[model samples]
Target: SADIIWQHCTVVLISPASALCETFNIKMPPNINVLRGSCVTIPCSFDVESRFEKYLDHTCKAYWSDSPSFTSGNAKVKPTKDMTGDLTKKDCTTTFNNTRLLPGKKYYLRLECKNDLKYTFKQASVNISVIGTLTCSAPAPCWSHPPALTWIPNRGQSQETLQENQDKTKVKTSVMNFTASHLHHGNKISCTAVYQKNRGSPDVTAETSLTPDISYSPKNVTVSVSPSGPVPENSNVSLTCSSNANPAVRNYTWYRADGDQEALIGTGQSFIVTVSKVKSTFFCKATNALGCERSRNLQIDFQCNETQEGQRLPQRFKTINEEESSKPKSTTQLLRIS
Candidate 1:
């Protein structure tokens, strides 16, 4: 007998009375925010205890719901999406690409981490809001810098380094160009200004609101190389920038190719541009008070200078051999009496 053992060996398992482990563990921060028509990621960390054994497929299942009060009149609950569970790493998080949000609206989001097997959730809820200007690329600026003006650096609206004029005014000049689509209606387009107030100042903003009444698409643009072809070099090669427009064209800009630098040959609708140097290529740009037209790159060439070739007569003025035999008496010409 082994120390008076019991008649039959009995097995008993003991577990801590207070240690009833919960299902999935979750933790999140407060005051998280998201923007409308944008995406949001909810961070979560979890340690799956042995309790979540049944729901194998639901391991990846995630649930999201909006506030019930938001849909008081509607039968359906608020906006929700599933499969947000970013279970990639040991620290699982959730993300949502929310497009259902309206401008200046508030939304509450809740995610339910449900185990399909246990039909229970380790869930969390958060309240987020939408603010800030609803900005997309504004109408590609309907403006351009004429040649007379100095060229500023090519800067976009977002990265513009603003500078103030001598009068302490903002140089809010933006020379950009792009086609306008139907989405441009009623949109608040902005201009970058040195003065913060000028950014929102009615004077600084282009209130005309790109309408069809304006020259939305360049129209009635007529380009001509005056005197047509064989327009001699070192002479006036006129270029006319004519347009049938409402506002009418106030200025003209001429662009020439194959020059050492970008050259503005002339201004005005009818440009009397003299060709001094060898003409490689020629193009004229026309613009009104509204905007500048795209460049018309033309091809042109120059003829050799006829005056440069051959010798000239001496200062003594040598007589021609043919003139000697045909000499005749010179008579006095009648003068006009006015």
Candidate 2:
């Protein structure tokens, strides 16, 4: 399910060519979101003149440029070999190492045919921007599917071309999906486009990142008691409540339930009390930003008849009437003594 959800992507395709010779089209997302230290797959596709179809030996070359024409001094090129698959086909998708991209820079895609004609399309190019080095707050939410827990890709993968829109525009796309865990929280994810002008020249890239928004409620709520088992009457007892949560629980409360109603007894993670009652039942509530959870009820009995020396006392103590009648030299006590 995570894999299926992670495979989701929103693609926008370039408008179809009005003329047969004007067959160059680049389809990609206007912007990309990525995590830091991760690789990015740029979905790309193109078409060429029918005449060039005969030149199977000719391969399509991809590049990035700061200028629209890609003739600027800062232009970076990616050779045909680095491209994901045979660029002579309709798909020209590529993968870029995000580490090579600089943040806050805008780049454009340039396509060229390596042949005697030296065909290069400058009339239309796609713009790419590199944003964020760490933590993306808002990632694109999936509309067709729920959010997925996945990891970034480490190696390059194959490309998939799908038809988009009512006109069935062929769009090339690459997917990188993995299982997401707590370790990925607050980390950056980036999608980068890599380009190189020549074998000896330096490579250039564009990328962006996002901080994942993970949400969960309190869980594993539990209550622990100190000096466990059969508490002595009037002795001090301690109770601690604990739970796990994403935002961290901010408040903890203790409650006592006797009969008809439950009453709040204390606040915080620890509750201390003098055990005077014969029996008592308590539970704790842990609250966080997401939600709250209550622990299971804990019952304690404080009627143990053990002496300081750990010996059991007699079951019967002086009755109320017997102790009152024998207290002083009252008439009844005097007559009984006489």
Candidate 3:
């Protein structure tokens, strides 16, 4: 009678034919780390006794078990859907797809053959460690084209190993690439590696994620005035400049349109001025590392009142034609009733 014994975290059957049992061997990585929601590959291989080898020639199955007993009745058993192993060749390479493996959990590998002896191996297992996804590399600055987003492999880095045996087992790597834009900022990009231990078995996967760092210049520039209506002569008014930008605007320059020339009036996001009898056109330039954007010209009208002291107050003001005002003007004179 064969007696089941647990030793070194492995389940083994000791029987009179225990010498033949020594021929069986299983090889796999001790542990693997994967990104959540991604795929992973498990490199696996095994050898069986010559007599039992015939049993594995057909109708053989592979699976992952939560227990070392390798019992099929165990509810914790997970079957691989994508097993690449060939019993004829004695290869047991397998892949797991989109595996959401839990962190700090161990999953064991098991094999079953459809023979009278009901051969099962539960001595080999691999631990699964779930970790945070990787982020996309920092965006490179671009003036004419969008930046390229490159994928960085896990901390362990992507690598492949070849196993030398009667049947050769090979491991492969996964990669992805894309272009990034401002719209993709803060968006998560993921990479997954899938692994299988045998044919028809469920897939196991490891995944990681990255957030794109997209840079862009200011857009939709506009200027706002504190007083909504016509400005009274000598009244103080405030002008605010605003725009949309990534990495934020580094500087805001206020400008006053004199005839056709724009004169830098102040530096900052806001400007203050005392209204004169003359109407004036104002605009602002917003700048950042990427580039600069100018706001649409704003026209401020100055209204005046005639005083009993014989001071003539202008009743209305007109903006100079932008086409004609493009030339530099040395003086801006308001209408006066002499």
lDDT (10s digit) by residue, model 2, range 161-256: 232445543222345433333333344444443333456876543344344433334656788777665545677778888776556789999999
* Residue lDDT tens for model 1, 88-127: 2334355556543322112332223344332222244333
Whichever of 1 and 3 has more lDDT, that candidate is 3
TM-score of each model, in listed order: 0.26, 0.34, 0.35
Candidates in descending lDDT order: 3, 2, 1
Cα lDDT of model 3 overall?
A: 0.51
Question: After TM-score superposition, what is the CA distance of residue 73 in candidate 3 from its true location, in Å?
Answer: 83
Show how many residue pairs clash in every candidate, following the order shown. 1, 18, 38
Off by over 4 Å in 2: 1-213, 307-338
Clashes of 1: 1
The residue-by-residue lDDT of candidate 3 on 33-134, one tens digit each, is 444345666676778777765676566667665445545556254545345577556676766666533322345556665664244555555554322222
Assess candidate 2 and give its TM-score to the true structure. Answer: 0.34
- The best candidate in terms of TM-score: 3
lDDT values of the candidates? 0.36, 0.49, 0.51
Judged by whole-model lDDT over C-alpha atoms, candidate 1 comes out at 0.36
